[model samples]
Target: MGVGVRVGVFLPAAGFPGMDHGEVLAAAVEAAVAAERAGFDDVWIAEHHFMSYGMCPSAVTLAGYVLGRTERVTVGTAVSVLSTCHPVALAEQAALLDRVSGGRFRLGVGRGGPWVDLEVFGTGLDRYENGFEESLDVLLAALGRERVSAEGERFRFREVAMVPRPARPMLPVVAATSAGTVRLAAARGLPMLLGMHVGDAEKAAMVEEYTAAAGDLGGPEVAHVAAGVAYVADTTREAVAVMEETLPRWLGPGLSGYRPVDGRPYVPKDPVEYAGLLCRLHPVGSPGHCADTMLTTIERTGVRHLILLVEGAGDPALTIRNIARLGAEVLPKVRASA
Candidate 1:
């Protein structure tokens, strides 16, 4: 048996039509708490606002709530959009969450995926990359150092100090992909969280790329977390059939960036075609199959931390059942054999 890997749950609290907002959020909370009870190591919440896909507008807020509710597992924002707010304010919120959580808070910041929120927030599209980079610089300085200073294309500040500094080490960056983003993370001496959309082959290559990038930057070894959909059922046939039925609907506009072969976004086309493509990127099968897939993923990606981004179908009951199965069947086996 190899050393076990860290597994975390990515909370997807939806605000679908006809569903009360409170109920959706409550369901997500219950699921997260169950995952912790299932012996998961962390719970991650993604930031999305005014969207039916994900009702949660504030990952930090939800993270704090989760931390307060749970005792052991770390709670973190899968990513908080960096360009959406001032660096100091984001830093304070993160640091305060850490303190409140008794150092069980992990933060992941990103430039954010596509949405109309940029215009809504009045952050123009032009110079977005520059602005995001600048924001990250300022954010890292504030979290890691007592005094923060920055002069950049989007922001300019001088020797500002964060009043409530982080109690633990500053949180690592999540949702960092692309060679450019990996290089940035390496330069900052932080780990990168690879997206769930990535396939095993791509994940392995990315690990290599990140390692080389860190070496070139004369930085420390760069740790990384791999993420993807995971499910375990009584039979492989049942699991695959279930995923094919539920996942296409689950893959909405939010996941348009998860390009399959031909390097194009997966449009809703032939159901069979789309499902096949999604399967290439996800793991869904019997317990033994899921365990084998996870083991192969770890071997290929060299990532010790694995985040199960999707559980059961949209059905709440199925979601909870899958979590239980993962904990009871797959998790123990993986730990013993990893």
Candidate 2:
């Protein structure tokens, strides 16, 4: 509503049913370019390993690829699983992406999900909080051109200078948080990228707590508080159909590894049932309906940035068209009201 209510579209590089990996990756690059041309402000990619649902195991790498193709739209990892990758390497890749994108790169970091199968990669989940924090410290220090000497519980670094610092002295860092990670982000003075599935009540509380805590830390006011929600179609009925058809196959039990939330159930047996549940949290309807829902949510939550996960929609073409329509029709009205 603040005129800069950024509306972004998510590109799920791997999750589409029967989508060839190579073609899906290509579509992702194309989607970034299309989103930019369609007047979106930012494009986000996710990080998940060994999962058919999300092919981008390394968002930094995919971001680099997007950088080569798009010129104006900002590119970012919806999250880079910081607990699994070395901070120095992560910093280097981010710096390189910033360079390629000409300073249009933002960063989102988080503790890797439990379902990510870190054990197979010889990584332990114990001390994840420590590792996530230290990695952020190291990344920030490296970006600021300072030699880092970190000897924490999970990792040890000895006064090593990382080269090729980001073009921007302090790259925009958004810490991905839910109920569990919100306090951590506030403690570290980082902006937050709320996850895709939080309910309305929880989402509002998160924004309030984050803003208050960030103020107390004397940190820069949150640059953006972005929430991810699935956007399905041009009409409520059409949207319902898409969600009904796709949600079950994708959320089936065999794919439990894709979602790491504890005790969260997979998709419901009936599409209408799932649609009803998701609609409470996601914006899924016609352009006008979506606009109204989004505006109401933003007004209530004070969330400045909105990232719509159109990737789950059955048809990519429909998703792209809806995004363009949202940009042209929905955002302007919302901004006027704000």
Candidate 3:
């Protein structure tokens, strides 16, 4: 089989300095176009509600907008938190987007963030996993046009037919999960989008568990394992500098109410510490080094698809250049080695 690495740009609304909302959107759209031109196979957008970090709260809407601009690139939701929205609404929106994109839409779902987001939605954190499971069942049944009637603890859906079915019968549905949710994805035979932002050891354990569970489920296609990381500049020093400058603002006191580890916030206080953490989690280095890192990661984890989180670096232009560099210098070598 031919090897493919799907590179995506994560669009965050919170601009670095000297950039506003309109500027950020414009820059992100430009970057998406650049990614397409640079030969990246697919692009995925994220969903977050009431967070300055994620501008696109509605991923399907943004994917529709991006679909209008690009011809060949596959657009998808990196992880639409299923617990927050009604399954029928999400199904209808995804179906419409799939039609608009001529079947270039992929669906990625997750249980969502911890307590803070749950509070915003008036949902208890304890119900996150249950809500996700119920929502997924509703969504899949709706998409398949199955007469769904369920009276679960979290959701109750009567016999209903969701209109505007997706153009493709079997649209790829990926489960975005960490260690806690990996087994669920495997047991259900869903492809996994592994979060690489969590440390390297965690990522490795997650991959290992996912692979073993997938094997138990009859060895289905090894189900695409895509890992993501915030890729930065040409050198280790520049990468650390970028991380140092952006981490505090990105994970500032706005999130103070959330529970911290040992009274320290979930985010790191020192830039160097954060940078070291990111370096372990992400493949941040020169293009050649990054390529080698990706290859090694693929060999170790057997992940077929890779999503590089380039927008975290705080410079749109630099992010675009890195995309080009990765497409030109990184992907080819990786493919050749494969």
Candidate 4:
């Protein structure tokens, strides 16, 4: 049997200091194209609003652009925050992209933080806290059927047709951080996008929970996606040095930009410590080390797909090189082992 392993790149459109918004966006697009050139299977775009951490407020829109720029690789939204967006509207956009991209677009949705975006978008904190489930239900309904309507707590709308209906039913990838979200995805027969900061054991447990929940719903076989950092070099020390040098500069200001709408204290991580931790947890080393690390993660979590955050070097050229090196050097060993 063939090894069912897929590797993709995550482009955060990170708004690091010293680079303008245009530069950041251009870099993200460049990385996506390079990912395809490097033989990766997909490119996942991240969404954030009013934060230096990520400048892409509209991940679906960006996915469309990336789809236009690349031919073979699938382009997905790492997550379009569902709370601040109308589910139907996002679903329509996803459908449109799917048609235009020839079924290459995947919509990944998440419950964003209680940030000021809720107020700016007029979605309110209740939407962030209690409305995610309702929004997800509406999104799923809109994607699955041609004609749909919602009479839910947060949304009440008459039946409407999904114009330019999707050619194929699109199953969204849910970003799961806790049991509640994991169960939510599992019950819906959806795949979870596990986060980067989590360890293999934690991810394995979440997978177990999801499998158990899915078993109750007839045990459909699912392939979850694990997100992690990726950087490579001739030696482990060289790779670690590059990440330590570049990641902290971007992680600091980018992380500090979050503002809680409810006046809650929001403390960003210590960039230095967090970068070091990520280097340890992720595939940041020589080719052998990188492969071994990813193999362990795949084995422990039973996740067949991996979406790696590849901009740790904080430079467009270096990030592209990292993607290429990973595709050329690290992925072969990983594929062989799996």
Top of the candidates by TM-score: 4
In TM-score terms, candidate 2 sits at 0.88
- How many clashes show up per model? 1, 0, 0, 0
* Candidate 2 lDDT, 111-151, residue by residue in tens: 87654355655566653644666667777776777566667
After superposition, which runs of candidate 4 have C-alpha atoms over 4 Å from their true positions?
216-220
The sequence of per-residue lDDT tens digits that candidate 4 reaches over residues 1-338 is: 12788899999998878888999999999999999998899999999988889999999989999999999999999899999999999999999999999999999999988999999999999999999999999999999898999888889999999887888989999999989999999999899999998989999999999998887652435878999999999999999999998899989998998899999998989999999999999999999999999999988888889999998888888998999999899888887788
Report the lDDT of model 1 for residue 254. 33
What does candidate 1's lDDT look like per residue over 52-146, in tens digits? 56768899988888888899998888788876677778899999988877898998888774345666677755434567667777788788898
**RMSD of candidate 3 to the true fold?**
3.4
Q: Tell me which residue pairs clash in candidate 1.
A: 2-338
The local distance difference test score of each candidate is 0.74, 0.69, 0.67, 0.91
Model 2 worst lDDT window (10 residues)? 253-262
User: Candidate 3 on 127-154: residue-level lDDT in tens?
Assistant: 5745676667777777777455668787
Ranking by lDDT: 4, 1, 2, 3
lDDT of 1 at 123: 70
Pairs in steric clash, model 2:
none
- The top-ranked prediction according to lDDT is 4
When summed lDDT is taken over every stretch of 10 residues in candidate 1, the lowest stretch is 255-264
